[model samples]
Target: MKRPLLFLVACMIAQLSFAQSKDEKAVAAAVENMRKAMIDGERTALENLADSRLTYGHSSGLIEDKPTFVEHIASGGSDFVSIDLLDQTITVAGNTAIVRHVLHAATNDNGKPGKVALKILLVWLKEGGEWKLLARQAVKEPAK
Candidate 1:
C-alpha cells in the first residue's frame, strides 16, 4: 500500500512539473513576441500581446495604460534599436506567469540615441487560450 501511494505521489509530481514547464515555455514565447513587436514597431502585434488593461511602468517613474503604451511605441517615442534580454526567469501559477529579466538595449527615442540597462518584471495572464501581458515595470540597473 505504501509503495502504491509513493508511486501515485511521484506521478502527480511529474505531471505538475510537466505542466509548469509547458506554461513557462508559452510565457517565454509570448515575451519574445512582445519584444519582437516592440523592436519592429508593430503596433497591432503589441496590442494583441497586451491585455486591454495593461499597466506599463518605465524606469523613469512614468506609467502608461494600454493605449498610451501602444501609441508611444507606434509614434517612435520609445524606439528600440536593439534589445538583449539576459538572465530571464519565468514562474507560472495557474493562469498567471511572472517573468523577470535584465534588459540591455540601444534606443533611439525621437532620434535621441541612448542605451539602457534595466531590470524588468513582467506579469502575464493566460486568458481565452492566450497569454497577454498584464503589467510590466522596469528599474534602471546599477553599473557593474
Candidate 2:
C-alpha cells in the first residue's frame, strides 16, 4: 500500500510539472505573436489579440482605446524594427494571466532611428475560449 501511494504521488508530481511547462509555452507563444504584430505594424494581428475593451497605455503616458490604438499603428505612429523579449515572467490564475517582461525595441523615434528599453506589463483574459489582452502598460527605462 505504501509503495502504491508513493507511485501515485510521483505520478502526480510529474503531471503537474508537465502542465506548468505547457502553460508557460502557451503564454510565451502568445506574447511572441503580440511582439511580432507590433514589429510588423500589423494592426489586424494586434487587434485580434486584444479584447474589445482593451485599455492600452504607452510609455508616452498616453492612454488609448482599442480603435485609437489600432489606428495609431496603422498610421505608423509606432513601428518596431526589432523587438527582443527579455526576462519574461508570467503568472496565471484561472482565466487570468499577467505577463511582465523587459523589452528591448529597435525603432525609429519619429524618423530618428534608435533603440529603447521598456518595462512592459500585459494583462490577458481568457474569454470565450480565447486569450486576449485586456490591458497593457509600458514605461520607458532610463538610459544606463
Candidate 3:
C-alpha cells in the first residue's frame, strides 16, 4: 500500500512539473514571437499581442500609446541590427503572468551603432484564452 501511494505521489509531482514547464515554454515562445514581429517591423503582429489597455514605458523616459508604439516600430526610423535576450524570468499566477528580462540590442542611429542594454518588465493577462500584454516597462542600463 505504501509503495503504491508513493508511486502515485511521484506521478502527480511529475505531471505538475510537466505542466509548469509547458506553461513556461508557451510564455517564452509568445514573447519571442513578439520580439521577432517588432524587429521585422510587423506592427500588426505586435498590435495583436497588446492589450487594449496597454501602458508602455520606454528606457528613454518616454511613454507611448499603443498605436504610437506600433507606428514607431513599423517605421524605418529606428533600425535594429539585433535584439538578443540575455536573461528572463517569468512568474505565472492563475490568469496573469509577469516577465522580467534583460536584453542586448544594437540599432542604427545617425549612421552610428547605437548599442543599448535594457531591463524590461512585461505584465500579461489571459483574455479569452489568449495572453495579451497589459503593461511593459523598459529601463536602459547606465553607460559603463
Give the candidate number with the greatest TM-score: 1
Report backbone clashes per prediction. Answer: 0, 0, 0
- Cα lDDT, all candidates: 0.95, 0.85, 0.82
Give per-residue CA lDDT, model 1, range 12-130, as digits (tens).
99998666477898999999999999999899999999999999999999999999999999889999998999999999899999999999999999999999999999999999989
lDDT of 2: 0.85
Instruction: Encode model 2's per-residue lDDT on 29-136: one tens digit a residue.
Output: 789988888888898898898889999998989998889878777567776789998898988888889999999988864676888899999998888767788999
Tell me, by lDDT, which candidate is best.
1
TM-score against truth, every candidate: 0.87, 0.82, 0.80
The residue pairs found clashing in candidate 3 are: none
Where is model 3 poorest over a 10-residue stretch in terms of lDDT? 17-26
Off by over 4 Å in 3: 1-19, 109-112, 142-144
Residue 41, candidate 1: how far off, in angstroms? 0.7
